[model samples]
Target chain A: MHCLNVELGERSYPIIIGSQLLGDAQHLLPYIRGKQVCVVTNETVAPLYLSRVLEALSEFDKVDTIELPDGEAFKTLDTVNRIFDLLLERRHNRSTTLIALGGGVVGDMTGFAAACYQRGVDFVQIPTTLLAQVDSSVGGKTGVNHPLGKNMIGAFYQPRVVIADMDTLATLPEREFSAGIAEVIKYGLICDEPFFCWLEDNISRLMARDPQALAYAVDRSCRDKAAVVAEDERESGRRAILNFGHTFGHAIEAVQGYGNWLHGEAVAAGMVMAAELSHLRGSIEAGLVERVRALLEAARLPTAAPQGMTTEAFLDAMAVDKKVMDGRLRLVLLRALGDAQIIDDTPRELIEQALQTCGAT
Target chain B: MHCLNVELGERSYPIIIGSQLLGDAQHLLPYIRGKQVCVVTNETVAPLYLSRVLEALSEFDKVDTIELPDGEAFKTLDTVNRIFDLLLERRHNRSTTLIALGGGVVGDMTGFAAACYQRGVDFVQIPTTLLAQVDSSVGGKTGVNHPLGKNMIGAFYQPRVVIADMDTLATLPEREFSAGIAEVIKYGLICDEPFFCWLEDNISRLMARDPQALAYAVDRSCRDKAAVVAEDERESGRRAILNFGHTFGHAIEAVQGYGNWLHGEAVAAGMVMAAELSHLRGSIEAGLVERVRALLEAARLPTAAPQGMTTEAFLDAMAVDKKVMDGRLRLVLLRALGDAQIIDDTPRELIEQALQTCGAT
Candidate 1:
């Protein structure tokens, strides 16, 4: 098992990445308090990963499970209440630790449930999908979606530990895997030029599920994410760079209806557009934008925004996003393939031109 | 104005207490970042306090207001979502500061909405009711109610500042005034002896709307709570003592329905039962219990559990609280009238004896 520390003092925790590490939970026993355990999962991932986790967690005295409907809409206040129902049914308390055992949807919802159930409770992440294992599992952003905005409601509460089992990805769909690769590529594009070049060369090996290549990709992505999150856990400044394509991406997901387009896919396309826009505005060289388009196309991720989504609607949606600062559009622009900067005073003409290029017209 | 610092370091903010301070929002002005401000209040408190707050914050380029239905039942996820709806409608971004203007219920729901709206936004507390002015306004315990548990879904996001307008108490009903007094006395009974003695001598003056007495009560209670909360912001240790009679109090509030009994009224009775229970277990002297009983009775608050509530119902209700440390019953019992301690392993007999003495079957 490889342990990566997030290093934020007391709020810090370790990310355990390895194959079949679900059984390595005994080493994690010290951090857990109370005698009860409640595992929170969802419909899609439960049948595939729940039993493996249950078998592994059999050492704990009492454990209960609450399975939720599988979708972005399910990440709502109602779902949070359902977890409360499970916690009350099992009589879980402050000391009781909750286990989030699924993808970003379940991790976000479960982490939120843990945050709200009796003010807050300690919860562990056993992320099943590639997207969750690489990203959502580490950041302490716990919350449900409001009708108006995706993840509009949440808290910056870290998990007790993150157990990222790469073996679980065997059950992930091809489309989902492609979507996750988009985020995996995000780490390379943002902070690691060598890793970006490595990804450009190894996209097929990572896609073909070459165990070593996939493992390396996941670990590197998590490490990069963990480092940024540790320095600016709550998106104060440096952390905003981590949301490279999320502002426009959230607009696509919300306007397109969540679950229709995968989050990473939307973000992949959005980043290409952001890079293209930056190139036009002289922030980054045109060659870098072409490289981004080439990389995303290689991963079989979307490089174009969803059709029929109007530029006005897209702007309206992006305006409501938590990321937009001071009435100015805060767009994460690529200075180069491996270097990024979040520009708050993004020019309206540049944004409009990018939207038109991405078919948001 | 009286500045009460909560002492959470950088996250720490001041609670400004006085009459008509809402008219001069200079303290709140420094915390305002963006040009937009969204004031969250309820239908009831809006007509009374909203205009003053609006006038004070008129300097903001764009200001909006969302008035929700008043009452405990209104403290639901639905109401929290309504704030999100208004925020999205106004295109309020991350820098938009939410000002919670009303009683405890409004402050909690607004603060909770602010906590979740686009992950989080800057918020100010314009708490009008006496209960809010003293307690919920200062602490960042923001959340809405779940069907099973009170404050079932929420976060610990502190406001930029808390503006408590004591003059708003003029419009509060007699019942509401009495309810607010329950928490005021709690600070004394749990942590401060001199304050407890002072409360005994001044309860009538407070009830009579003596401004000086009211100011002293709010300041002292907030001061006591501020220190404990700084040590354990999310109720890890010393903060639990602040919940002296809250276990029983919340049970009564939940079982009887949230608005059926005023929170403070229920807490007033709960404190008496807790004192008696402490005596039953030999943790507190009977005379001290009587002194608590006398203060509650003098305030026209119930001293025993309500008429139709059965011990089984109470126990079932208590089991769902966030304070149930584990499967075991955790009670904040008085080591004396002027101090309290959390007993994690309370014997069933002592609980039964206290319930029986409180006239419950």
Candidate 2:
């Protein structure tokens, strides 16, 4: 296993990546300080891997579990309220660490619950899916979806520890895998051309869940994410690159009622749109956009926008996006496939063209 | 005017205490970065002081307001949700500083909103009530009440500045003024014997709204709280002393429903209970307890327990209090009027007796 530590003083925590780490979590229990603990997960993941986690935490009988409905739609303020209620009902204190046991949605909601439960409790992430292990579960970006936006209400709290159990990905559905690779691919396109090339070479092995390729992918991705987050935990500046496709992706998800597209699937489509915008704005070559599109198609992720959405509605939704600085929509466009920068000055014509290419009105 | 700083790097801000600080907020706006400002208050405080605050910020056209229902019961997760909703609806960004314009409840809820809005935004406190100015609005104790407990959901997020308008307290109802004095007295009881002596001599003057006495009280209390919070922002150690009466006070608030007694009123009565326990444990002299009780009575604050509350209910409710350490009650007891210590090893019979003295049975 490879380790990357997010240096946040006493609150700092580690992200570990390896094939058999799930079996080694017993060694990681020192981080969870208290008599009681609660592992929060979702229906999809609970059925496949909760027993394994419970078994991992066999030392603590006070261990309990809560199963939320799976998907991005369940990442609502109401869902977060439910988690708070559950923790309160069980009387979980600040030391009672909440273990998140699913993908990004589960990690976000549980981390948020931990952030607010009894003012704030410790939490650990046990990301079961590829998208989560490499990304969401590592950084402490915990929150529920807002009525008007995604990830709007949250805290920049760090987790106790992040335990990515690679074996759990064997049960993730094919479509989920494709969606997961979008984020895996994002790391390459943003800052690491070598990792991008490595991913290109090993995409099939990663898709097949080959232990070595999967471990390497998770480790390298988490290292990159941890380094970026260590420098800018609250998204003051450098953190914006992680949202390279999120500005457009969030609008897509918002317009489509959020859960209609997998977060990664929408992001895949969003990245294509963002890259095309970068091309039109002269930051990235048109061929780079084609390469991004080709990679998404190869991974079987969506590259086009959702059907029947209007540019005006998309723009309206994007304007309310948390990424919009001072009311102007700021897009994180690729300067090239291996580089990205935020663009607040995108012309109306280019945006309209990108929307037209994506089949939006 | 008296000034205190939170000392939390960029999150650090000042607390200004004086008789007429409401109208003085305009001078503090140079620290405010953007044109948009959102003032969040309740109906009662709005009519009393919002106009004065608005008059100070007349230079900003984008001033918006979110008026929540007034009272401690309204300090719920639902009310916090409403604030986030309003911020999103209004498209308030990080540059938008939330001005909390009421007592502890509004300051806490607003500060909590600032902590979670867009992962964190700047907020200023224009605490209108004595309880807010001298207590909750100073330290970064911002959070909403959970049905399970008071402040069971919150963060230790500091404000950009705390503007305590003592003149606003002139219109405060007598009961609320007495309630607010509980926390003012707490600062003396927990950390400063000299201040305790000072307050003992001037309690009558403060009760009469003597401006100089009020100014000294507010300033000293903010100084005490700022020093503790600077040393321990998250209640890790020194900060826990600030919750001298809060464990019992929280039990009272939760059992009676949040607004049944003003938070400080419950805390006032609770301070007496803690003093009684301290006497029983030989940590403090009974004479000091009498003085604490005498001062509370002189302030016209409740010094004894309420009628008809049973010991079992209080005990059960307190088990859920945020101060429960390792499944046992961790009580903050006074060594004297000003020197306090957290005792986790107190005997059950002693606590039961203190409960009996407070009419909890």
Candidate 3:
């Protein structure tokens, strides 16, 4: 088992990574502070893993479950309200713990519900997807999407614990598995150069579902993210670096419409565009962009924008992105591999050219 | 102008209490960090004071106003979403400051919108009602009511500054004005004995809208509430004392339907019930409960539950309150005139008796 603690004072919690952790009560029991528990999952994940979590929580005084519809399209305030409705109808109080038992969509929505339910309650993250385990589940950033933006409405709410069972990846579809690797690659590009080299060396082992390699990648990714998030929980300054490819990725998701493209897939392509812009800005050599593309290709992730997505569409979507400040778009461009910087003064033409370079019309 | 700071480390902000603070740009602009400003007021308050606020914000590069529908009925996630739509549609970015320019409903929905819009932005509370000025604006409790319960879905988001202009209260309806005094009296009941005495002596002057008496009451209520809030920001411990009458009050508001009885009116009646409960528990003598009723009567506030509301309704409503933990009802009762305690093991029969005693059927 691998464990990493996100060092947020008072909000600090552990990320437990191992196989079959869900069926075990030890990892899950200590973190649940309340007598009542609500397990929030999705249709797809519920069929596979919900019972194991429910079985683990059977000892609690009261246990409930709500299987939200699976997919990014279901991640909206309306969907989250369903959790609130259920919680209220069932009489879940401020002390009840909400366990998110699916992928990023489930984790994000459940965490958000916890943040808002009765003005806040405790929640645990049992992230069943690599995309969630490595990124969303650890950051304390939970929210739903608006038609105008992705993650446009949410809170920076931490969880009591994040249980990432590597065994769940066995059930993840090949495409979704590949998509998760995109964020694993992101940890390398943003702040971990040695991990980038390790990823370059171990991409096939990770793709082949090697448990040891997968666990190592998840731990390293969480450690890197925790360090950044702990420094700036609310994204006041340095924390913006975590959104390296997110601004562009959110644009792709918004223009393509949510659920059309997996978040990690859009981010894979967005990371390529960001790397290209970095090369143009003379912050990194073209070789690094190629390496990012080569690594993503090995994992079967998208290396460019979706078919027919244009620069104009990207511009319109990015205009409403949360990263924009005072009418200026703040783009997180790579100063170098393993280092990213948020720059607001990028020329509009440069951004458009980068989009064109990445196959946007 | 009297300024008091709510001492919450980085989130601490000033509450400016005085007459005509809204028309002055200096009171507002310094707290706003960005050039773009959005004033969130209601249809009722917009005609009265929105123009003055807009004029105060005229020096900003971009200024926008959203006039939400008036009353507690409009305090919903749907109404708050309107603020989000306008913010995105008008391109209000991360640095834009949202000024809530009305009563508690406006302040709550706007503050909640600011809390969730783009995962939080700067907001200022320009409370037009005495309820908001003395209580809601200073506490950082921002949320909208749910159909099942009041304040079921919300966040504990603080503001940059709270501008409580005494001038706006001139046009307030008499019933609503008395409703605000319910909270003003609450500050005395739960924490300030001397302030309670002062209210006893000066209740008529306050009811007559004497500017000095109103300012003194608002300032003292804010200070009392601020002290409790600062000690326990998220209502973990001592802060629950600040909710001395709220659980019962929320039940009244929920059972009677939200716009029928003003929040303060419901709370006024609920305070008497809590006092009755305190007397039943042998914490205080019956004289205090009678004195509570006398003071509320002097202020023209209800000192009992609505005529048709039953003990069954109170039990059903109170059962789902946020204060309930592990299926046990937690009630905040007065220990004496100016002290309160949270007790979760009160017998159900006693609670029903108190409700019946307070005019519930």
Ranking by TM-score: 3, 2, 1
Interface RMSD of each: 1.8, 1.3, 0.8
lDDT of 1 by residue, A1-361 (tens): 6778878788888888888876665645766888889889888878887887787778887889989999887888778778888777776777888899888988898887787777788988888889988888677988877778888777777898898888988878988898899999898888888999999899889889887888898889998888888788778898888888888889899999988999999999888878878888887887888888888888888888797788888888887787767767778888877788888876787788988887777
RMSD of each: 1.8, 1.6, 1.2
Error of 1 at B237 (Å): 1.0
Residue lDDT tens for model 1, B95-162? 88999889988889888888777677888988888888888966689888877778877788899988
Per candidate, the number of residue pairs that clash is 3, 0, 0
State each model's CA lDDT, in order: 0.84, 0.83, 0.91
Per model, the share of native interface contacts recovered reads 0.83, 0.65, 0.82
In candidate 2, what are the lDDT values of residues A189-208, reduced to their tens digit?
99898998887777788878
Residue-level error in angstroms, candidate 3, position A78: 0.5
The candidate that achieves the highest lDDT relative to the unseen native structure: 3
DockQ of 2: 0.72
DockQ of each: 0.69, 0.72, 0.84
Score candidate 2 by lDDT: 0.83
Superior candidate under lDDT, 1 versus 2: 1
TM-scores, all models, native as reference: 0.96, 0.97, 0.98
